[model samples]
Target: MDARQTWSSQLTYILAVAGATVGFGATWRFPYLVGQNGGGAYVLTFCIAMIVIGIPMILVENAIGRRLHINSVDAFGGMANGKKINKAWKIVGWMGLCGAFGIMAYYMVIGGWVLNYIYNIIFGNLNLTSVVSADLTASFYDKSIINAPFAISIATLVFVIINFVILVRGAVAGIEKAAKYLMPILFLLMIGMVIRNLTLDGALEGIKFYLTPDFSKISAKLFIDVLGQVFFALSLGFGVMITLSSFVRKDENLVKTSVITGVLNTLIAVVAGFMIFPSLFTFGVAPDSGPSLVFKSLPIVFSHMFAGEFLAVAFFSLLMIAALTTSLPIYEVLITVLEEKFKIKRLKAIFITLGGIFILGNIPSLMATNLLSDVTVFGKNIFDAYDAISATIFFVLTSLLCAIFVGWVLGDEAKKEILFGSNGAHKIINIWFFYIKYIIPFLILVVFVSSFYDNFIK
Candidate 1:
């Protein structure tokens, strides 16, 4: 194997991981989930989950990566002091790679939707007018984009090619460069959208719906749902943090870096709620519109708002950039595995990975149209089936295993890496250890079982 390339600097490392974590899960998925589960109650559970589960897992993954300084698979196969561990632990790495690949397949398809929206909005193909109705907006999304297989396929191919070009450039020049520039622009665009949405008439009612707590809506399922969201939002158990942190400087403080990334990611998801919910309420659109909230509901709001076309272009552009930043990291996890495990050259690995993703991604892309609309896996269409398996099964299972590996198997070595560069940080190390060893594993196992019941048995 070749010598691994470290990040250009600490800032770039943080930005790269932050960029990966703060993607569509926050901008596209979080708002709809909040809407579906009851706004304030879901938000409350999400915040608690972040504190209890999200940040601690970030620390665990980063610690393991920096300590071992290898690919995700080998990282679990050995220890820091040149000691070999049980080969069975490699399952965690495999699960993470599978999860990352599964996510990328459908993620690129969603990216295509964003790209198509941008193109249609800019060229006036969407036929936006002053007297647009909810039905009209829904029709545009359904007929012109979702149900059009050829258009979606072309868009998805374009997105795959774009990622292929970036991946060939290597990490520092490709992934880091993209994150450094795109993350700032993503946040600025989101802030602008939030301000615009807040200024709209009847926006306060939306804000109230978003911010006011309704404890009555809380349930056992809500906890499971919120925990899964935190995992997805923070890129936990997908080998993203582990792979990214493998490139961190030896003297870097893993705890501080994890905390910063967690805080930034969580904040972006909250801001997304501000950006989306108010607009939905202002236009009297149902907040709980499920997956179509952004694609369907927001276009309607933009049609009725001032400078609607301009905002529409900007919003989708923001979504595309966020999607790219995230897709790059997830793609990297697959590339790294192939390059390290098979001794393949980077260029060869890039082609192999992209080719696989394109082929697999097409299933979901075409399923959106009549071509494969009848296809179902586990009672979900291909797109939703991919989402459930990646998020509920692979993500949760990999996370549960990682907690056990780091907490029990790697115990002291993991602690040393977490506290490496920080003086006087020993006091809270015990608390963190307690959470990772006992609390996080138990909680994740509950989610894993509950998800199976909800998806299969229930």
Candidate 2:
């Protein structure tokens, strides 16, 4: 235990990080967002944001983690080897840890819903049929989620324990191994769904709508949505990239890894568009069903198609895999901090973290039902309140602080370490530094403020 654990290889690191990046953000949210917003235009905006904002921040986080060789809190706590700077900066890491835990709380609830869907499919409990309208799907959500807290709790516990077993095994054997297999299977499932959907009659119409850029639909709102999606999709501001990079061997090229992971994440999201849009059009289903696209509408599509039961199983299975991969890293964010900071054993850290999340996180599940349905905070229910706090507020604030810290405080030291073994290191670092210092931070602030305004005031 004296020696720090590191990923066995660069490939494992890529797969693991990609697994984290490609979860619900790409697999679930991206497709539906494309359907809701201007399909091709939203995708294009997302790509640009990924380059300007996503890649640089990712590199910054990875650089900080690898350079500090510590958990998120201490990573910021020891910046520039200065005591006062370290003490103040530690708050940044704590904010990130809070964001991670906050996200995990509600995220596990959604993960449980996916688990329930998979179970219903297996047990033939869901009598899905025909293409459901947006309202109908919305009604389904109202009828379903959190109606049975016992069942939801069971599913949540199952999800948490699965993560625990994987995390308890340590970095390479646990996370890397799960990512190596799960990522491939997830991709295969996506490819299969896309191919099957494309083969359906009228599928091209959906694809056309998705790929055709309707510039008229582009608005200020769409732009903000794209930026938020890119940030959330890349898992920025969560200290996840930082934690993941801490396990990376020092010789790995941070820029190369960041670019690869970012590109892979975007590509998977685009491909998911092909899968979702085509199926929606082919089945005569409307595209802009918001969040219900996956849980409610997609299953309706499956119910009407050939081999519906099999496809339904595969689709939900894909979601479960995506959710599991994403949740594992967030769990690690807390477990790593607890183990490193408190000097607890890994087993002890896992239980302590899970116990806390288990007790505290499920409040969202309760609020999802009639018991606390009338309860509201900041104009949102408990579940949405948690999401806004973690996903929007904390995430954006943390990313802004990270950009400022790397751009100004870490300064030359970070630049040198980040560029250490790469070709054209100086030029690349200059562009990255420019974005990290000036551009990315500003965009994060805009996203942060706008999100608050839209969620609370406007």
Candidate 3:
């Protein structure tokens, strides 16, 4: 098979990347965030916000991927008729490419947490001691808590190794194959957790908190946050979508595939909410749990509940699978950049990238903050700093770039590329051009600039 000719149908392509997008951040954390935002209304607001804004941006992204058939760094270059044609756009590509590196630097630290739980599930008896849970959580952040740093570092490396192995194998085996098998597993586990959580007392409050909307709390910024979360949850800006969509079969329906991705990703998040909120309310654990929601919040809630240990085993396993699936794509982007840029073989690129990232990733050995506080920003820590900056940099630009590319670069050609074999979706295509060209770009620019001021100035 020719390396360039390898491709997946729109279904596999969307699902694979969607699996990456639908990480623990959405499933486990949505309810937690909703709880913080005061209840079901936040989730309610998030849904509307996601569909309206997130979906269109995603469609625009697929257009870039399918049209150019290249990675993020070079996608702009290829579309401009080579790197020299519209040199500035390449900066967009560089931002995305570097964003991928930055994401994995900290993502592995989080992935390490999942890895640590998995290790405890497999070999060691997970001490349900509240003291132990507090100790473990503290270990992740507390310097005086010696075991936490070692555990986080080890877990991060384990995640890096797994990613290196899969990506070195290339797309079919690494992405498509993994997506086919693992997505089902992740979903099934989420469904299982939902079933278990709902059966508990106070579960309905969790459900209501997740699904019911507090109309008064529905503010403009919260709505925007939901929109951004939906996009981030879908992992669109990490450049994985652009890189992965490069492998799509030409005859596939780009619009339909994108819609399907939106639906699947949304469904998983909703399902995860059901799984989490029910358990949360039932346990009298206030649903507004924050970072402690996953590591600290739930474990404490489950300790005194029915079949808590078994459920913990199931929850962590599912969470790990979801994280792993997402981690694979980041690894794919990092290694692809190296191979394409340096003319290195894929295997060598994997090792070089893995070793380099693993070392740099130790910055998050602060996941618990025992020895060092997470590198702080306006009040956020190192992890949030990376998440905020990377998500902001990649997504805000992709939205703007998609608008420019489809509006100007492709123009009439944009319709043709999107409607390539997708002949019937013309109505939406017409609106797409208008949105991409005029409406969205300005919105993206405004939000991008505003966020900078908000973060740095006040």
The regions of model 1 sitting more than 4 angstroms off are 80-83
User: What TM-score does candidate 1 get on C-alpha atoms?
Assistant: 0.97
Judging by lDDT, tell me the better candidate of 1 and 3: 1
Candidate achieving the largest TM-score = 1
Superposed by TM-score, candidate 1 places the C-alpha of residue 364 at a distance from the truth, in angstroms, of: 4.2
Q: Highest lDDT: give the candidate number.
A: 1
Error of 2 at 249 (Å): 1.6
Q: Per-residue lDDT tens digits of candidate 3, residues 286-324?
A: 565575577666766657566666777788888777878
Q: Candidate 2 at residue 52, lDDT?
A: 77
- Tens-digit lDDT track for model 2 on 229-277? 8877888878899899888776788889988988898888888888788
Q: How far is candidate 3 from the true structure (C-alpha RMSD, Å)?
A: 3.1
TM-scores of the candidates are: 0.97, 0.95, 0.90
**lDDT (C-alpha) at residue 189 in model 1:** 98
Ranking by TM-score: 1, 2, 3
The residue-level lDDT of candidate 3 at 152 comes to: 74
Clashing pairs in 2: none
Q: Model 1: per-residue lDDT, tens digit, 80-166?
A: 445778898998999999899878878998888888898888898875556478888888888867788888888888988988888
